[model samples]
Target: MTDALNDDRKGWMSLLAKAPPARLAALMPDLPDHALLRAPEVGAVMVRGRTGATGAPFNLGEMTVTRCSVRLAEGAVGHAWVQGRDKAHALRAAVVDALMQTPESAGLHACVLAPLAAEAELARAVRAGKAAATKVDFFTMVRGEDA
Candidate 1:
């Protein structure tokens, strides 16, 4: 795949990872024929973080993650790793990932990815609003000590 296509796939995969499984199932009721290359399984992945935005990376901790891999009948392969122990979420995400690589990708992007992305953005906005509401501004004042 070209760099542009790879980038686009990354965006869709992110949306799938963040999306709720039930919501994705609702959007795509019928999945195309596929074989499970890897059954959904829960595991731990080392979570890493930086002290600040660009600071040195450090191991934050271990997080529970579920992963699955699927291959469509037509040969497109997909894989997914989602946080938590929701096996169904991982499976559904893998299916979507495979579909995103097929010729039906455009239609799926419009019908599925677009809505999921919008919902994710809305959720993010709501969280940001709540955080902003609790934000406190700090300031310091200079006193006329030498006058």
Candidate 2:
């Protein structure tokens, strides 16, 4: 796949994985039947983190994850890895992932992906706002021997 296409797919996949299960289900449309290449399976993955966003990575801890793979009737294959052991969520996410590559993607983007992105952005903004409210400005006063 081209870089642009791959990046676009990556964006939606991340969004779907992080989306709330019940909310994603509610916004989901009538998905076409698909063949499950891999049934939903739960597993644990080691979480990694970097200090100061540039330091060497360190193992944070283990996290529960669920993954599923599906092939759409139209030939597109999709896979999903989501946090937690929500089998249904993984299945639905995989289905969406497959469908997003087809011609019907425009409608799905408008109806499902758009709202999810909006909600995610709004929630992020709210969290940022809360954090900003408590921010401490450490501006050094002009008390040095410069005056």
TM-score of each: 0.86, 0.88
Residue pairs clashing, model 2: none
| Candidate 1 accuracy as lDDT | 0.91
Position 76, candidate 1: lDDT: 96
lDDT of each: 0.91, 0.94
Number of the predicted model whose TM-score against the real structure is largest: 2
TM-score of decoy 2: 0.88
lDDT of 2 by residue, 1-147 (tens): 999999999999999999999999999956688999999999999999998779999999999999999999889999999999999999999999999999989988998899999999999999999999999989877867877
Per candidate, the number of residue pairs that clash is: 0, 0
Regions of candidate 1 where Cα sits further than 4 Å from its true position: 51-53, 137-147
